[model samples]
Target: MPIGDINVPIVGKNVVIAVLVQSHILFAAFIIGAVLIAATSEYMGMVTKQPRYERFARNLARFVVLLFASGAALAITFVLALVTLFPVFFSYLQNIFFWVFLVEAFMFLGQIIIVYAWYNVWDKLAYRKNLHVVFGFIAGFFGLMAMTMIDAVASYMLTPAEAPATDVARTFLNQTMVPLNMHRFVGNFGYAGFLIAGWAGFRYLKSTREDDRAYYDWMGHWGIIWGFGFTMLQPVIGYGYMKGIRESAPDAFDRIMLDNAFTFNLLMIWLTVLAVAATGYFVHKLRFSVRPMPFLRKLAIGGLAFTALFSVLNLIPADGHIATGITFLGGEETQIPLGGMYPWKYIGLIGLMLVGFFVVALYLRASASGFHWGNASRWSQFALIACSVTIVFTMVTMGYTRESARRVDNDPGYLIYKCITLDQKVVSENCPAVSDGVNTISGREAG
Candidate 1:
C-alpha cells in the first residue's frame, strides 16, 4: 500500500511517530550510557578495593534492567507505527539497508541476552569479579554495535550518500554518519553520568542514615566526573558533525546556522551558561583545605567570564539584514552575527570548550591530591543537580535543532532527504480510489 494514502481520522501520524521515537531515543540513550558508567565503577571497585564502587555499580545495573525493558517496549511500538502507517517508506529503507538492519537485530538480541544474564548472576559471579566485569563489557559492546547500526540509518536521512542504492556499503557510510556516531557515542556517556549525579543528589538530600548520605555523596561526585569529562569533548566533535552537514547539504546548514541562527544560539547560550556555572561551582567546592592553584583559579575565573560574554553575544539579535549570498525558505527568520561568522563564533565556542576542560582537569587534580568529595559543600551537590538539568535540556534542544533543520530545509519536506513519501506527494482529488492501498478517501478504518 502507498504510504500516507490512508490518514486515520482520530490520530495525527506525525505526532504519534514523533512522541514514540523521541521517547525511545531518550530511554535507549540512558540505558546505553549507564552500561559504560556501571562497568567503570565495577572496575574501580576491583582496582581500588572499594566496596562502595561495586555497590554503586550493582545498583546501576538493576536500574538499567528496568529502563531497558521500557526502552525495548517503546522501540517495538515505534517500529510498529512506522510499518503500519508508513509501510512504503519503511519498505524502501529496508530494501536499501537490509544488511544494516539485519546486523542491528542480532546485536540487539545479544545485548538483551547478555544484559539479563549478567544482571541475574551478579551475586553468583561475585567471587570471580573479573569475569563479571567482562560480562558487563560484553553487554556494553553489543549495545554500542546496535546503536552504531541505527546511527548509520538515521544519518543517511540527513546526508545521504551520493553513491547509487546498489552500493550498500557506500550508502551505509554516508558523510555525516561517522561524525554523528562519534557525537552520540560521547553524548550517551555524558547524559548518563549527569542523570546518575542528579539521582545521587536526590538520594543524598533525602537520606537519614549517615552511611547512606556519604555513599550517595560519593556516587554524585563520581557521576559528575564522568559527565563533565565527556561533555568537554563535545564541542570539537559537534563542529565536525556540523561541517559534514554543511558540506553535504548547504541550504540545510544555512537554515540552521544563519537563517535560524537566533533560536539555535539561544540553546547554545543556555547550554554554555549552565554547564560552565555548574562545573565551576563544583570545582571551587572541590578545593579542600589546600587553596586552589592560583593559576588554575584564574583560568576558571577567565572561563566563567568568557562564558558570560559568549552567552550575551549569542543572545544579541542580528541586524535585520540576512547574511548575503545565502537563500532560505524561512525569510522571516532572524540571524545572529555571532552565530553567522567564522573566528568570531569560533572564538566564543572554543573558549567555552577550553574552560570546560580546565574545570574538569582542576577537579581531577584536586581529587588525586586528597581533596575528599565526602567533605564537599552542600551547595556543590546542588550544583551537580543543576548540571544534570542542563544536560537533559541540552539533549532536547540539540535534538530539536537537528530534526527541525531537516524539515524546514527539505525540498517538498521529504522525511528522508531526496526520498518522496505520501506527505509530500500529491494525489488527484477526483481520481478513483486506490484499492491496492488503504484508502482514507471513503473513510475506511485504518489500523
Candidate 2:
C-alpha cells in the first residue's frame, strides 16, 4: 500500500511524528551531554581529590544509567511512528543512509553497555580510578558518534549536497553537516548544564542541613559555569550554520530569516533571557564572594548592562511584519530602524559574545577565590531556574524555526528540500536513479 494512502486521525500525521521526535530529541541530547559532563567530573575528582566532584560524578552516572532506558524507548517509538506515518519517506531515507543507521545503532548499543558497566563498577574500580574514568569517556565517545551519524542525516535533509544521493561521501558531508554537528555538540553541554544548575538550586532550597546546602550550592555554581561558557560559543557557530543554509537553500533561508522572522526573533529573545539571567546570577554571586572584590563586581555589572543592551538590539525586527497575520504600527508592514541582519544583528551577536566572555571571566576569577556557597540569595537561585526554563523554550524554538523554514507559504514542502516532497515523491533530477539496485518508483532493476 502507498504510504500516502494511510491517513492519521484529526490530529494529523505530521503533528504525531513531530511530537514523538521532539520528545525523543530532548532525552537523547541530554544523555549525550550528561555522559560527557559526568566523565569530566570524575576525572576532576581523581586529580583534585575533591569528594564533591566524586559525589556529583557518581550520582550523575547513576542518573544517566537509569535515564538511558527512557531515552532509548522514546527513540524506538519515534522511529516506529516515522515508519508508520511516512513509510515512503522513511524507506528512501533508509536506502540512502543504511550504513549510517547501522553505525548509529551499534554506537547506541555500545554506549548503553559502557555506561552501565561504568556505573555498576563505581566501587569495584575505586582503586583503579583511571580505568573507570576511561570507561565513562568511552561511553561518551560512543554517544557522540551516534549523534554525529544522525546529524549527517538531519543536515542533509535541510541542505542536501548537489551531488547524486548515491555518492555516499558527498551526501554525508553535506554543506551544513559540520556546522550543524558543532552547533548541537555545543548545545548539548549548555542544555545539560542549565538543567543541572536548576536541579541543584531546587535541592539547595529544599535542604535543611548546612552540608547539603553547601554541596548543592557548589553544584549549582559548577553547572552554571559549564552552561554559560558553552553558550557563548553558539552565536558564531550558529551564524556559520545559517550561512550554509542561505547558500544551499535560499528559499528556506528566506522563509526563516525574512518571511517567518518572528520565530528567529523569539529565539533571540530566549537567548537574551539566558544571557541576562546567567549574568545576573554571576553578579549576585560575586557579592557573596569570600574575598570581596568590589572592582570585579562592578565589572560584572557593566558586562550585564552591555549584555542587555546588545540583546535588545538583537531582538529588533528587520521589518514590521511579524507573522503571517500580524503587523506592527497600524497594520502596515514597514522597515524598522537598526533591525537589519547584516550590520545591526551581527553587531549585536558580537557584542553579546564579548560581554559574555568578560562576565564569565570575572565570575571565574571569583570562583577561583571561592564564594560563601550556602549564603547565595534566593533570587540568584531563581535566576538559575529562569535560565533552565528559557533554555527549554530556546531548543524548541530553534527546532521549529529550522523545520518551518522548509514549509514556506504553508506549502506541502520537500522533506529533503527540493529533492523529495513531503508526500515522499522524488522531485529532483539530482536524486538517485536507483536504490538497492531497483528503480525508486518502479521497483525494478534499473535499465
lDDT of 1 by residue, 110-203 (tens): 9999999889999899899899999999999999999999998888776666655556777788889999999999999988998898888878
lDDT of 2 at 275: 98
The candidate 2 region of ten consecutive residues with least summed lDDT is: 438-447
Best by TM-score: 2
TM-score of candidate 1 versus the correct structure, residues matched by position? 0.86
Clashing pairs in 2: none
* lDDT by residue for model 2 (34-125), tens: 99999999999999998999999999988988888999999999898888878878888898899999999999999999999999999999
Candidate whose lDDT is highest: 2
Worst 10 residues of 1 by lDDT: 438-447
Q: Give TM-scores for every candidate, taking all chains together and pairing residue i with residue i.
A: 0.86, 0.95
Question: CA RMSD for every model?
Answer: 7.2, 3.5
lDDT of each: 0.74, 0.87
Off by over 4 Å in 2: 330-332, 428-447
